[model samples]
Target: MHLFDKEKIYGDRLLAVDDRDRNVTYDQLDSFSGELYRKVGGKKLIFILCENTIESLSGYLGCLKTGIVPLMLDSHIHPSLLNGLIREYHPAFLYIPKTCIEKIEDSEVIWQFGGYCLCERNEKMPPALYCELSLLLTTSGSTGSPKLVRQSSWNIDANGKSIACYLEIDANERPITTLPMNYTYGLSVFNSHVLMGCTLLLTTYGVLEPDFWGFARKKRATSLAGVPYTYQILKRIGFMDMDLPDLKTMTQAGGKMPPRLHKEFALYAKRTNRKLIVMYGQTEATARMGYLPADKTLEKCGSMGIAIPGGRFWLENEQGNEIIEPDIPGELVYQGKNVTLGYACCKDDLIKQDEWKGVLHTGDIASRDSEGYYYITGRKKRFIKVSGSRVNLDEVERLLKEQYEGIDFACVGTDDNLTIFMDQLILDGGEEIIEYLYQVTGIGNRTAAVKCVDQIPKNESGKTLYKELETTADNRIQSK
Candidate 1:
């Protein structure tokens, strides 16, 4: 279902959104979006680079329902990269916070940040609405080029509903939005709340400080949504220390949480008698595919869990055959409505597999337990999970290659550490480079601990030798 119908369906019921301002009701939200739609001329592409705020949400749904495509770029993106994405998307309109408008130039439709601009639309201008609504979100790939994954209303809506059903989010629930609105996981939280008429407390500032928990408790939050690193912060500040009476559940997704932390949270839930749901998903599916039930969290610890409603998942062996046993390792493949239409496909070659049906061939490795719970073993390629954030080894190499004199580099991930071995010549400012990394990756944590490797082993064709690099990583871990 389209997002407009949801606002209509909820009517005057509570849709409290705690954004930049205090709180907004459904009527205010609906009216605000309607006004923005009118100002947007009902459709086209609008680039959002505003801080996470109520205006952002209003603008996002406003563009969606009114037949416009909203191209989302990270608000904190580099100036050069931001300009590149803008040129690539060539959006007809641009809507950011009123404060950011002065920074950008050349747009046929530029809506003021806070105020609604509802000018009449010319029939000759591009149609505001399209039969298929989609978004172009950047996915950091190994190729160094930020690929845009396209998703639709129907795909995302079903995904949201599946999450709501699995997590049991309702009008009484309030989900804290800590991740960027541009990401699928963050967008899913927004969509699920909007679809169920639930509450969402949006904030880019994470719970790094102890006071953040107090704020969440003060809001009487029913739920908290966080990635792996977020759980790490909570664990650090005493996951068991805080007593949240209103907190019925919490969700973990985006990347895998370490088994050790997962168990601690499980015990905390056991003591508090609350639910901790470990989930898994990607941007291509509009966020969320598998989720471990709250009751079965500890029992199914370390697994990304089973597929959500209206979704089918299975694992295949290395030979590309389905693993018949309960303990066999296989690549996770998901078939669901929430799957994206296709990748840009060359631009058109972007979308891959399942031409006739809805299925996503995920590259990660996993195994199923006797109870049907799926546990992530590791990745097939050299991709790393640093602090619950997916970091492509090739992406890091690409960035380093652009700076270094040569184009040779390799990267790898350990159980909890990320290692980047350059040609040794490109290895300066060790700690300063780590600090700079925080700016590049907007993940809500001191996500990765970096180290230097003397040489990056590769074969004749220049393929990274995984066996040798893994040995080096194991030696480093032992040395530590």
Candidate 2:
């Protein structure tokens, strides 16, 4: 069931096409990967700074094929952050773009190909990896953190098969990349499409760029994958009116899409005779855990749908008892082969065996309808008591976004203090927003505050940097 197995791939078919119009075939990809694998010389751990390029992808496949564990990271990560990871993991090798070779102090280039090079660490010792350890991925918001989810080969294989099965992907499918390869959702699309022997349309251009759509049209890309922020950008850029007869499917994951946007896309898909599939997943699940069927997209507008094929979902109350009654919020739980082994906080933790077994207690609070569709209510940790009354921070953000439309709002605070951060341009409206929060959450005017910043901070994946906001909140309180 290995994705790169020669017998499973159509040797002559195009494996990927980059923005430069460079086409790579399956056979050529395998051959190039074999060369990279041999250059490793039995190294067990490597850090791959990933871009949506043939060279980056070849290096990744080579590691998987040869049982060399790789920690995929964004190629454009800050130098200090990258150095921190290098010191923590002590990878024996680094497969990175040629331009980045000068950034490493004690590394020597051992091999080069297609603008990328393999550099061996001169004074580093490779850490011992668990026998089943297949890959390492940073949580979407923790790019600089040493913590990484530990996934197994079986996790990748099972999740890939499940995604392909639900998406109905085949060799004829062409999915244009709209997310970074380091992100779990983006990586899942890559693995599943490759497993199905489909041609991947690789591009560094964003959805806002005209060149991106031009390349998609030229290649007749049949599918598109995006995160919640990507879809928002697409809507702003008039994606519904775009002409692309070849596009038959659109997939969204990475976070909860606003209900309004979700309905809009679902209706657009129905009108255009295309499929809009909404999915739910985490790095802990190796990619995907649930997907709303395309046919039910509009019907289950806000739901994340049922568990993926071969996966099971349930809700557990505070007492750890399974909640069988519908429409009651509880901690969401998932059971499947795709659930990853556990998290690795340091090099020594890499040798640890599976700790979660096959079950993952997703920290999301969700409710299942009578029809068995699951809808995320909020996060367990996202709730705070305002004057002894509980309030959901996510719900506050959602309420503001839904009412304000174009304005961006992020809610973060302690039990009795809720601070809403908005752009400096809307500082005049701060009082109005505070009043609105009081009306909705019943918090007193003194308990709620509004802070205007240059802009809300976000990670590369467009998720809000709540940790940064929390730190700012703490400083503000201390100063007061």
- Residue by residue across 404-452, what tens digits does model 1's lDDT show? 4333455666544666554453333445445545567642224444444
Model 1, stretches more than 4 Å misplaced?
2-6, 19-21, 108-110, 113-130, 141-146, 345-356, 383-480
lDDT of 1 at 455: 61
Task: Identify the leading candidate in terms of TM-score.
Answer: 2
* lDDT (Cα, tens digit) per residue for candidate 2, span 94-208: 9999978766768888888888988988744668989999899997544589999999999999999999999998889999998888888888998999898889999989888
Residue-level error in angstroms, candidate 1, position 392? 14
The candidate that achieves the highest lDDT relative to the unseen native structure: 2
TM-scores of the candidates are 0.75, 0.96
Which consecutive 10 residues in model 1 have the weakest lDDT in total? 116-125
With candidate 2 superimposed using the best TM-score fit, by how many Å does residue 446's alpha carbon deviate from the native? 1.5
Off by over 4 Å in 2: 6-9, 140-142, 427-429, 470-480
lDDT of 1 at 156: 71
